[model samples]
Target: MTAYKSREEVPLNEKWNLEDIYPNLQSWEEDFKKVGNMIDDVKKFDGAIHGANDLYSYLSLGEELGMVYKKLYVYAMLQVDLDTRVTASQALLDRASQLGQKLSAATAFFNPFLLSLEEKTLQSWIEEVQGLKYFEDDLYELYRYKAHVLSKEKEEVLSQMGEAFSAPRNTFGMINNADIKFGDVTNKDGEKVELTRGMYSKLIEDDNRDTRIEAYKAYYKPYVQLQNTIASTLSAAIKNNVLMAKMRNYPTALEKSLFGDMVPKEVYDNLIKATKENIEPMHRYMKLRKDILQLDELRAYDIAVPLVKDVKQEISFDDAYDTMLKSLAPLGEEYVSTLRSFKEKRYFDVRETPGKRSGAYNLGLYGVHPFILLNHQDDLDSLFTLTHECGHGMHSYLSSKHQPQISAGYSIFVAEVASTVNEILLIRYLLKETEDKHMKKHLLNHFIDSFKGTMFTQVMFSEFEKITHEKSEQGEPLNAEVFNTIYEQLFRVFNGDELVFDDEVKFGWSRIPHFYRPFYVYKYATGYASAIHIADKLLEGDSDTLERYLTFLKSGSSDYPLELLKATGVDLTTPEPIQNALSIFSELVNEFAEL
Candidate 1:
């Protein structure tokens, strides 16, 4: 993998074609001004809604303006993500953000107004206006939050405070992506150099214990040093969530976060509960790590190294993409071919550069194509990541293609199912294709580690989020010390007593970007379980399963996430899905032990 010193040095084919969104600053500026005018137009309807025609007018205009506004914001936001250190890009994004807040405040009256209407009046309006049919379902969905919705005035006030509510996340984004720097470590040439996230990924799994140790400490040094600062931002974020939950009349922050997805607290509760009841496999795997590595002590750094060290695989971006397409052939020719075109069309920003965001993600702009961001290193793990994100990309692409803008975006609750299904397919493909025993063992280890990361680790994080948010809700003080204690305790419970804790391990809570998004990680755990079932069925070549799964992707937010997954034959309301995933993990662990 080439180390790109700047975004310009990366190949054009490897970067996004932002021109797909906006051709130039002039075009972006025109859209910005147009959105401002549209915001003004929409705001005029605030005190004016009286009947069917008025409601239809407001809804249609508001939706149109929102579509344009999304393009403006995405174009600006994507540039900032490309190189976060750029002040001009930052300014552009700020403008877009403030515009979004204005749009939010402008439309805040709609929800409360809709909820205030009687069910009969709402139904009568839908009967009266043909165009209102486009927005009928969404308008009725407001009834679900009728108890939670505040007075129009208060809702407007809260909407105007959107940026204030998001400040901590924004501050942390700057800190994590653009400000914080990792310490130095000795590289292959025996010279010390400052570590980047890309480099740390490789170094952490180095065959040399000393190298892994050095990289681990150095990678964590900055996070530990800034622990209190990160803690402050995190505390503020959690407090903000709890505050919003209270203002919304929720029983708790967790419940409030789950409300949007229509996911019951039991689904959240059962995920953690089921995982803990089945956690012995995880502990057993940790002990297996110690035995296979022949170490008296296993640290957190020792956990990621491949137990099957005799096999090493290095995959370049091109090969990874080709392999990803091959693995996904089970999805069908159209699915494979469309995903192939996403690469040829430069849908991906594929290399790491200075000041780039550290991880991979797929952002689907409704009217535009899916833009995937990856800091891809040439390795097997990167191959999984490529497949993982393409799963998200395909979901985004299909969702936008099949549904109206209102229903085109899928819920976060089911988002991971798409991505993890892709990963399972890729790993299963590798497992089936490889003839060598060493390679198969490595693949098995990779699969086990992926399970640990996606399911177990996320469940651990879900529990951490739960505990921390509960503490805040209970009026407990949360600082660096409190975070450290909770995190270290969770780590010990999840990983078992086989490994000694590093001081840096306690500071693990400080590094996650996901915690900023409340009650979100649990979806990843749930999605992984749901994907395991769906992927296994697809592998069996069931045409009905394949069609339903594909439709589930295209269906997007047209239905609740659980209902969507249920259509694909994976139900999360019961513990069966989580338990089934755990069973697979246990079987894999035992299979590896015998090897």
Candidate 2:
């Protein structure tokens, strides 16, 4: 085994080329100060809007300021995201966020002013202003939420108080995930492994049961010790959601979140119901794991081991690039050509090194092409991550090319669909092309692992979130004991009679950052289910389906997510998509067992 080299050891030119965003930090600082000065100019928008014409001028000036602000903020955020520990980058991020808040407060009148328009008058003005054409849909969306729009002064207060109001959640993020300390664990070979959160996650996925158990216990002891404070932090965060919902006059915070995406409540409920009903496949798969590993019993820690380890395959970064291009061919030559450009342009930061972001993501800007951030280690997981993030990059590339800047950015509801679609397509391609039986079996197992994690497990977490939110709404104190109880039950439902849900796993909710965003985890389950349906269409070589899916990708915020998805022949409002995914999971489970 080799000790991985830290990023400092890697040549700077081969690393993240921040030169693409800015030539150097000094230039970035100059732009940062320019953006700071521009914020003062945005203050002019506060008193400019008195009517539709006034609103048009105000909006034009605001958009220009916003474009520059976006450029500055994106650079800062991308730099921070690449490695969050950089002190100067972190300071820039804070300043950018503060500037954003100030600008948002200044522009708060635009919506209320638009709401003041008579329906016919607003409609006429909408047609009259050529500058408003690209924003027609967003303006209409604002109109749709007119009833919920607070008075300008109240809205401005909310905007100004934004950073202060969310302090507890931010506090939790700092201490829990970033700076927490946990005990070290001894690996199978008797070497001490210092267990950071990232290392703990990778360790628990190890094939050795003892290594996983040791990692889990050592990693969580610190969280379990401070469970009360963690509970209070999360409780404060949840209460803030409830408070904001009440202030906005929404029925609930869940309603507030779903409305932003124009997602129906049924979409959430159906995901919960479909996943609960279909959890047997996951349970059966877990049982299979226990038997295959020849363990007396299965533990939560053993969930990530390969079912057949002797069939090993490793992919390098270059091989991954070529393989991804081939796997994406079903999306058409135009799509493949853009991916080729992404490769040639060195648009990806593809390697694992200290202090870099742990997971992988693709970030894109309006005027710029997408860039992917990864901690790649040439494993199956990293390969999947490359394709997944590429899905996002390609989606961004197409959307930016097709839609205007404002509408070019998409809602989070449909965000995961394209990525998962690529993952499914990639798996299908691998299985079809491989001649090795063991490798094929491993591929099938890999796909099953994806279904298990993204669909079944995420839906379970979503249910837990709903339960906790409902409990909090009833004024129940979300102490560790209560939180643990709810988590234990959900785990039992997903894990079934096969394994025990130790009390420690109850504190697991505290470890999941996604829970901080109310009702967010459900998207992963919905994304997985929806992607399967779209992948099936594309796999059958249906050009029309490809066209519709591409249209959905380019739609951005123009249409409701359900409407956009329906154009691709999948209605997330119904349970069909989730059920379809469950059926496919069943098929894959059976196929893997046979293999």
TM-score winner: 1
Query: Against the true structure, what is each candidate's TM-score?
Result: 0.99, 0.95
Model 1 agreement with the true structure over 143-245: per-residue lDDT tens digits: 9899999999999999999999999999998888887888789999999998998898889999999999999998888888899899999999999999999
Candidate 2 accuracy as lDDT: 0.81
The 10 consecutive residues of candidate 1 with the worst lDDT sum are: 306-315
Whole-model lDDT values for every prediction: 0.93, 0.81
| Clashing residue pairs in candidate 2 (N, C-alpha, C atoms within 3 angstroms) | none
Writing each residue's lDDT as its tens digit, candidate 2 over 1-595 gives 1235566665453466667777887886787778667666666766565555766776676677877788778888877776667898889889888888887887776677778778788778778877766667767778888778898888889998889777877888777646777877886678886776556656877777778888888888888988888888888888888888889888888888898888888889988988888888888888888888888877777777788777645777778878988998999898888888887777787765655666778887778678788777676777899999998988888889988777788867888998999999999999999998988988998999988889888988888878878887888888888888888888888887878565577777878778778888888889889999999899999999999988888777677778888899998877888898899999998988888
